[model samples]
Target: MSQQAALLHRSTHAIPKTAVGGQGCYIFLEDGQKFLDSTGGAAVCCLGHGNKNVQQAMIAQINQLSYCHTAFFGTQASEDLARFLVDSTGGKMTKVFVISSGSEAIEAALKLSRQYFLELPTPQPQRTRFIGRTPSFHGVTLGALAAGGHILRREAFRPLLTKKTSHVSACFAYRGKKDGESDADYVARLAAELDAEFQLVGPDTVCAFIAEPVVGAALGCVPAVPGYFRAMKAVCERYGALFILDEVMSGMGRCGTLHAWEQEDVVPDIQTIGKGLGGGYAPIAAVLINERVVKVLDAGTGVFRHGQTYQGHPVSCAAALAVQKTIRDENLLENVRRMGEYLEAQLRAKLASHPHVGDIRGKGLFWGIEFVKDKSTKEPFDAKLGIASLIQDTALKPEYSISLYAGTGTVEGVRGDHVILAPPYIVTQEEIDIIVNTTVRVVTDVFNSIH
Candidate 1:
């Protein structure tokens, strides 16, 4: 970042280039730099940067009824959007608690799950503990921060978080898979670890097992192995616990399906989703609840205990409705699948042979390329080297001026490095080739300097 950018109000020392305009798969910087939006603004913007239908929907909603507090009344936009999501989800998910941001939606889900237990005929007062993975991200808010497992993010706020949650092993194959372990064996090991955590916590005391179906920031788009969710779900059910999938980064057609778990062949009792839900046209997220939990709340309290000022904001719902509709109507998910395969193939063909490249893995339009110092032994570059950070910084100079996502501490708490690519769903094969070609050049350039 330049001195002027550093002086601005953004929190991080690394200032982001301003996005001026976008159409289709391109994002134009304030200085008129056009780059393929691979990360979808941190896995947001599913319909791409500037979708015409979503924008028109937002405009229409504003003209009709922009903002209406739900305390007094509800709008047709909110009601229709709710029905749309519920129906699309196959009607098994009975309720949607909308909020302004992903973190807010997570907060609401946590509170709602806790309150649902309280409303039960046999109240589970002991169900105060939340079980989460070791290297996962839920959100950035204090409560959501507590539920997350990013040590660097949680370091400062450890004292502020409630001592109500416990950490477990994440189902990451690259780092967590044991020596010579089969996929089933690895999943069994992870499930055992979770079962042991339940035993340690006294199963009855736990509330939900929270995890990202495909991890986003912490592990750089790491998807759990097959049968991983099923095994984990069994453990949760054995303990009479709830399974909560944080699809905030993977759901809503980002992975070429409506839900990431659909590919996993399991269902979450409570699911949290955002980013792509409203396509960045308006800030929106949702906590999707199954019928079992809703029945408890319906029979006992008859009203939810939580509230948000912007819950179910009509304009946000309208924008999301249009975004979802366009995806279905235009068959954009097909494009996501086709382009995603091309992106993966190109990444593999280009960087699979690179010396510093350790692993490249992802699905659909979401992908990650991990880097290391020694490929034979998979030893990471020293953190002081800041390989990932350097790559992030170097890509933004006057020469390249491209935007990419970088991550660190991929192995343990403070080792390993990788970069993520989550292009928009509407990306074309031609544009994907450009993204792949530029990425190869960028990685080659960054590693050349470091080595």
Candidate 2:
């Protein structure tokens, strides 16, 4: 084995293999093994890998102007990308702040939400608390972490996390809905729960209600029931609090639409997007400000009292602009819809009846297969079993030659296991078949061995 490097990774017990190269949806390791990248490295690589156009765009920007402080100058790359994003939303979102990663974007969103209250005409100094959905995964930064509801992730850092953020039950129909309860009833119940929380916390004391339009890793691709988002948004509006949607994993065409909230029939006061923004070519994320929020800042302070050195980075913006242009010019959103339908059909047909396969959910190119110990009761295995982690490891073996994103704590923040598959937008029918067949084989083998 090679000597351990000086870098600190997520785990100190294990070091991952070195990825030497990648093309399309497959990554090549240094040892010459190839593996299909199903989850896009946590749903980030929308354009797959090695796209010449995005590369050239980034390289050209680096040649012309690589780095510049956002305070000093505004590059064409940032301005053009921001304009494209605004146009994409039909001016619903009037301003954009490009940052390096999803975590940073989320941090900016939280801070901006707080700042928005402070800059209001009346100045709501008491609006300091935030409300988010349970089992949500927003980001890792302190403010973002406080707003997130992943118990396992927040457990160790609980002492340092602010108590200002509170969580309501997520719109998880699989386990949350009762057998006799209708969708409308369940949504009303959840909405009432949110309202009661606001009342308990003092409605006027809340700054915003934040949630992912479609829940991601923490809950394993669970989209809300019909009218769920609208109800939540109404609650926020009733309380005069902002509605913030964290689309870090489900945005940028990953959910068939450019924005997942498009399907929900609701507009957010603030939105954070990453993962698919730069398609993993460069580290980038963004916060899109609604015109209402922009208006308050425009009228009051006339300046957002926040600054980051790498905000609106030129090269990252160039790469992201090219990525967005490719999605539009190539009409990839249409492909996402088509492939999403095909992928859903294949998954249900192949694994829906499997005993361990409790649920299959997601939209567009992003999907998740949740595992259970008992399908009849929907009982999750114990956390110590590490089923999700095992699937991830076994899928990367030489024989399998597949890579999947795995998650635990799907049922709240402690139990349940799931594996997510988020293939690239350019994937084809043949590749889809391979992905499904390999997934079936891998899951079957893993369980077969255990039995």
Q: Write the per-residue lDDT of candidate 1 for residues 90-147, one digit (tens) a residue.
A: 9878888888888887888888878878988989998999999988888899889989
lDDT of 2 by residue, 217-248 (tens): 89889999999999999999999999999999
Candidate 1's displacement at residue 74, Å, is 0.7
Clashing pairs in 1: 38-422, 38-423
Please report how far candidate 1 places residue 354 from its true position, in Å.
0.9
In terms of TM-score, how similar is model 1 to the real structure?
0.96
Q: Identify the leading candidate in terms of TM-score.
A: 2
TM-score of each predicted structure versus truth: 0.96, 0.99
Q: What's the distance in Å from true for residue 76, model 1?
A: 0.9
